[model samples]
Target: MLDWIFLFLTISLCLASRLLLSKLSNTSKKKQTLPPGPRYIPILSSILFLRRSLFDFEPILRSLHAKFGPVLTLRITSRPSIFIADRDLAHQALVQAGATFADRLTATEASRLLTSNRHNISSAPYGPLWRLLRRNLTAEILHPSRIKLFAPARRWVLDILVNNLKSKSETGDGVVVVMESFQYAMFCLLVFMCFGERLDEKTIRDIEAVQRHLLSSFVKFNVFAFLPKITKLVFRERWNSLLAIRQKQEEIFIPLIRARRDRKQQPGNGDGKNNSNRIFVYSYVDSLLGLQHPEDGGRKLSEGEIVSLCSEFLSGGTDTTATALQWILANLVKHQEIQAKLREEIEGVVGSEGEEIKEEDLQKMPYLKAVIMEGLRRHPPGHFVLPHTVREDVTLNGYLIPRGAAINFTVAEMGWDGKVWEQPMEFKPERFLAGGSGEGVDITGSREIKMMPFGVGRRICPGLGLAMLHLEYFVANLVREFEWKAVDGEAVDLSEKLEFTVVMKNPLRTRLVSRRKD
Candidate 1:
């Protein structure tokens, strides 16, 4: 017993000493010449405040920026992270130094759970595979012609939503739709985008149920992700649940893929007899089947890669868009003047002759576009853009950001900066109009990061065009048909809570009266 105790003590001491020595060695190389930030601890660098309220991060970050200047060094876990609030510095990093910053590998739990990290655009590093997937998405699915093909899907969703609203008003039960209806609509649209056809409503519901469970499980586990590897072993149940979700998603997706393959392989007696009769592939699955790396000339995507990519598209498009739509509508509800003006513009331009508003019409309404931009800026759904990793040691504002450090930038901060906007806290659309400073601020461009709601640089959200279209189409039609006002006794709550995006803690509850007569 005495010998065993001695040996254990020796082993423990040696491990501690080695860890201390390693940390000290790394610390020795850090250049303290950069912008100032909180001092680093031995471990748990800046993680103590991660659990603070969603709104707290910005104020804290801004305080640091105020004291430290545009760039600051933050050590989250003994790893030096560089945070940039200055537009110039951010532009430099994203445009000029883009190759130096790439996506960090998703933690093991996130990869196993989200399935978003497996081989999808978001998870794949800056490399040949990433380029292949992004190019295929842009060329085959998100191209102008392909988006034009999706017009029918948008019309279908609009009809369903209008019918649902009419039914709710007739019943007069005052239904609390809380984000779920919005999420369902988004999921239906994106599911069709991924699978090339609409599944039955029951099928869509079943998939959503499983996905919600999986998302909740994934989010719960992600909070503890920065902990040591051994801590992950204790999270077996969460992992198991995630695997079950993966299995469920695969079961639904594989049959569709198999059907498409079998159809392509069918014998046609050399006459192409059934070619015209076969269901045309319109969604991203077709693109996946055709993808080839530009540099390598590799074969088509493997089954796992396809599954992961589809899952990422489904998940990304669903939650992010749903959250954003609700936020936009919530603002419209809070400010009726804004909604009325948008409806008036739509009516004047499109005129209600019973024709569905075409995609091309969205471009003609500058005020509506300004309102959308303001909503995106005021309430950026994603507060913290996905954390980026620095690949090499580099100096930003004279501070050394060491290689292999994980950095997270504040997206909402740039949009809400008081210096940039007059009365930044208020919801104002006029600020983004023709004569406004926001006129030339393209959210997609990296010339300067005035407000990066969709992020900036190479990793900017590729689906920004789709997101903007959804917002405009839905907002225009909803306003044309209904007058949104706050419930007499109940107010629209604007408080926020964080998940993948900054969502309203209390969903905006309001009365939707028909505008047909009003």
Candidate 2:
């Protein structure tokens, strides 16, 4: 009923807009030097878009790329989405001319609501605020030194994971669904980092439920992006649902925020919460608590904005790492020889099967690191990075990128380029070792972008180092604890699914046989 009403109200407006655009498009066609793409049919484009899922259009886009060239355009909606698959062009725009293309796409109504109208780091325009937030995250929370403080949290989460998997595999046919465990483990680690305290299982799981709901339902609310004035009225229920999710987040997050704020003031919390007088451990929230919003009269972050920031911190840390971990593990299960090789390396480096794998220990095993890198190269968590908006009109490889045009890099395509990798489709950890083409490659893409799983340039994820540590630590330990085996009649499927991240279409279900003698 609401849908019909909004469509009814917008139909005439859309037709009028289409007629106006058809005239403008024709005039601009002669003047525009934009990349080759399907001609926009205005109203027909909108109707066709309404019939398909947003991310489902990738196949069509790939075909379009093949027909047109490395750089092509698609007027997926009224806005043209420019995609870059060629490495040199990516380097030129995102690296050589990064400042010119550093701006993010204009946020939708839903995005603005969630990001507090660009309050957080990722969505904020390229400016002082983005710099501040990114710096704080990198220096205060994600710095290598700061990450060492969370070693205990990772260990605790690891114990919980190993125990959970062992118990899970013991049931029935002994095949365990691992994504749930992987995601939960990440939530455990990140929540501790965010809150500065160890929360109970119930609180951790509760937070996970709300945060995951917000991420999964994000696309559903993109409808609220269009005609939000009318859609907000028509889609009141959806709007309400979105608000409820946020409200739930605040209800949980604020108390945690307050507790951290309270902890800072509490003399004993600095020493930790016991008669033993534990030294106070600072947290991500603690850093935010001290920050004054650069734009808001230097006012401290509002409770709502803190909630938004915390949500961003938690979401980024959780889903992307968890998705990557599952993919790496799934690949290990499918390729037992690779698994055996990595296991041998782990045992050799760590000395004893019983000795825990430390970060320094990880540094000693290049092959273990190579396996994690290959997994990222093979299955980037996000196929295309968050769309980038150009700061001004610019030409790349003779194609015009108008000011404010949204650009995206085809991340998976770059990783799979046969020209870049001798055989890109095959899982090959050896590619990262000495004498291979991928040897000594830099992920930051400062010199040239070969493959970017966590993206690159000014807007590259600040959490890159921390994420790599988490992957290597977790993957190394998981492989150390269990000899992963494929379930008969249930092959390890590598097919992709479009989620908040590009996840395994079939979440990895594998048999875990204990390597440790009890």
Candidate 3:
């Protein structure tokens, strides 16, 4: 009888303990709720996402932010896209608690096609591979000390741009439309940096055409990101078109790649292939030739992978900088007083004629830096950064951000925040000057994320330093060389249209008056 009683007691205790553990698990689950967003009816929501391309998706998100709040979700794919428009929350997730939110989402079919299964720095996951690729670019190529080495190359491209504009100004009523020239000029410079060769005009243009085509077609390929198995079949022609573009890219780039590889493998330690142009001191391709994939059994990068990386390097450095140059010049043209003031500042620093404004002089001209900063603030080339993902479930502003979900920050909105800027819409360079609101703003978001034209955190654009130098170098030279004036009939439109980067809806058509007279 006593033995039976003890057995009953043990069974009772086991049941009570199990009940207690189950109740605790249920309570923990109740605390995690997704950020409020549009009700996802699956098919309809996906259709809406497909219809609204990256270029036009802002308007939809703006309305959602109003109803749900700054931190919200949009389930456009199997995964949710959470956009953070608030600066504090963005800082909280991207900086303060960075490790939990540092990973990138799995590359979609469209991205994988371009990046060679996520090998490039921009698309690679946040791990050993991403670290290796990013470090290679930053330390090997884009380091601040290394940028000065490209001074001659910058001058070469500047001459090409100036001459191109001059020839146009000499004819056709002298209203030189500048966007195409800006892009081509950037391509020529970057090509030399990437390939270790100063390719001829025809070759540079050929590469430019292919890259521009890919960038413009980016929006059209978004459908391939969702239900790609079915979408590839449904949008068969589009898929084939993308494939054809990639093939043409390989054809153009592979020979250049092979030539570099062959030259490096030549007799006498590559000395036989010494370049006459001083611009060949180091090339981006040379670094790539020596890189080994960390996770892929230490194998050298394949030809296709090299081409994809080269494509990223070329496209990234070319378009964004070129687009930014146009806007800075456009604003200079639109506001003549600001242009004259800028010219005066350049004069103060660059005292001699026939002598170029070297990168060194860029420091003395405070107003010149201000103009570039204001241009970026007023019109960041990309309104939103490349999407970021979380490594683990995280909370921002009392909302749960699930692991692996993509997060996008509102770049343009942050720059234009009324609380941040006095006259948010105005093209005012003064804002960045001393006593101005933007004075000493930290763009890297390492301290605070005032504006992230390049993005922030561990994955912040590795090319940030290079991009700035290019902008300052080009803008300073272009202004010092020419007096940009508005065309008589057409206005310098600030209205934006999304291309690979957001560009002026109506491209800048300006009349150039040469500031330098021989």
For candidate 3, write residues 442-485 as lDDT tens digits. 98988877888888788787877888888998888888888899
On residues 327-364, what C-alpha lDDT tens digit does candidate 1 reach at each position? Answer: 88888888889887888788888885435667788888
- Candidate 3 positional error at 403, Å: 1.8
When superposed on Cα atoms, how far off is each prediction in RMSD? Answer: 4.6, 2.1, 10.5
Clashes (N, CA, C under 3 Å) per candidate: 1, 5, 0
Clashing pairs in 2: 270-279, 270-280, 271-278, 271-279, 272-278
* Candidate achieving higher TM-score, 1 or 3: 3
Q: How far is candidate 2 from the true structure (C-alpha RMSD, Å)?
A: 2.1
Worst ten in a row by lDDT for model 2: 267-276
Candidate 2: list runs displaced more than 4 Å. Answer: 1-12, 18-30, 48-54, 268-276
Give the per-residue lDDT digits (tens) of candidate 2, residues 1-518: 65755665595587688778778765654565789998977656765565555468788888989999999988766677798989889989888998888899888888888888888988999987888888988999998888998898899999999999999999999999999999998999999999888889999989999998998888778776567787788778989999989888889999889988876886565555534576566789999998887777988888888888999999999999999999999999999999999988888887545556888889988998899899999999988888889877788998889877779998888888988898899999999999988899999989988899988899898899999999999999999999899998878889988888989888899999998886
Q: Pick the candidate with the highest lDDT.
A: 2
